[model samples]
Target: MATILMITGDFVEDYENMVPFQALMAMGHQVDAVCPGKSAGENIATAIHDFEGDQTYTEKRGHNFTLNANFDSVEAEDYDALYIPGGRSPEYLRLNTQVIGLIQNFFAAGKPIASICHGVQLLTAAGVIEGKKVSAYPACQPEVEAAGAEFVHIEMDQAITDSNLVTAPAWPAHPAMLSQFVKLFK
Candidate 1:
């Protein structure tokens, strides 16, 4: 089983954070969920982003998710893979230099990384997605392109894997995204 590091923060999408964390654990992988400036046992508020008949997704308050690891204690080399969930959180997480460095470490190590929706923002900000094909929320396409990655416009329920990276547009693509991600472990 692999030890996966999940980097998340307040306002992270509920399903994106909860489902993958639980699903990976159910598969016998050790998943450590962490947030900047927080420690194990601490909790981060989540939000539900739903697509309605609107121009974009709608947000609603979601459950509080507990952290299982301390961000400061995380050593990127200790984990076999990285999981980054999407939501409004990525918008600011990208600004954290340590967070960007952590992501770069994983990329430099050639480890597998899975990102969804806005999570691509972190990868872009880390300057590690250049020359890759990445999928993220439609609103993130421009950033992906500007970061030198080819933006993949796919179905909401689909995912794409480029080298050691697996990405999807949103949580709806969990099945495809996770399946592809797990393959990297093999």
Candidate 2:
């Protein structure tokens, strides 16, 4: 089993955070979920994003996700893989130099990374997606493309894996994304 590091923060999409956290744990993997400036036992407010036939997805308050590890304690070399969940968090997390550096370490080491939806924002900020084929939320297409990555838009439930990177548009793609990420441990 692999040790996985999942970075998330307040307003992260609920399913995107919890599903992968639990799914990876269920597979007998060790997963540490953390957020910048937060410590073990601290919680982050999550949001539920759902398609309600509106011009865009609708947001609702979701369960509080607890942090099992301290962000300041994370060392990328200690983990075999990285997971970045989508939502509004990436918009701000990407601004943290430590966060971006942490992501860069993963890429420099060639570890597998799985990012979905707006999580690509962090990847772009870290400058790790250059020339990579990625799939992200429709609204993130511009950012991904501008980062020098080829953005592949697909249905929300679909995912695309290119070598050490696996990405999806939204929570609906969790099943595929998780499978691909797990395969990286092989």
Candidate 3:
């Protein structure tokens, strides 16, 4: 089983962010959840489920997938793959130097990297998606491309594997993306 590290930040899409967990584990890959750390060794995991951005919508209370590990404590060598579930989480993590560096390490190792929706933001911030073709929520396209990524609009159903990177738009493409990620680990 691959030691996969998955990260989530606040305003995360609860369902979409966590859905791939089931798929990954069922396929025999070991998935570990990660998020923003506050104090030393303290991390708070948020959900993307029912999270509404400032644009105005409804938001539901999210799941608390809390863990006790500082981002600095994370070692890229420990994971065989990485996943950044989309939501408002990426926006927050994109600004975190530690998280960005972790992402860089993962890519530097040529590990499988999977992201969905706004999740690409983290990769963009890490400068890992530069000149790479990617797809995300429509609103994220311009920014991703500006960050040196080639954005494409496609269903999130199947995992769009680009090099060691895999992306999807959103829930509509979740199934496929999850399956493709599982296969990557296999």
Q: In model 1, what is the error at residue 32, expressed in angstroms?
A: 0.4
For 1-186, candidate 2 gives per-residue lDDT tens digits of 999999999999999999999999999999999999899999999999999999999999999999999999999999999999999999999999999999999999999999999999999999999999999999999999999999997889999999999999999999899988888885
Q: What is the lDDT of residue 43 in candidate 2?
A: 97
Query: Candidate 1, residues 1-186: lDDT per residue as tens digits?
Result: 999999999999999999999999999999999999999999999999999989999999999999999999999989999999999999999999999999999999999999999999999999999999999999999999999999999999999999999999999999999999999995
**Model 1 per-residue lDDT at 46:** 98
Better of 1 and 3 by lDDT: 1
lDDT of 1 at 30: 98
Report the C-alpha lDDT of model 3 over 31-114, residue by residue, as the tens digit. 777666543335454554432456533456667554434455578998889988887778877888888888999999888888
Model 1: lDDT of residue 94: 94
Candidates by TM-score, descending order:
1, 2, 3
Question: Highest lDDT, which number?
Answer: 1
After best superposition, candidate 1 residue 57: deviation in angstroms? 0.5
lDDT of each: 0.97, 0.95, 0.75
Q: What lDDT score goes with residue 185 in model 1?
A: 93
Q: Tell me the spans in candidate 1 whose CA falls farther than 4 Å from its real position.
A: none
Worst 10 residues of 3 by lDDT: 43-52
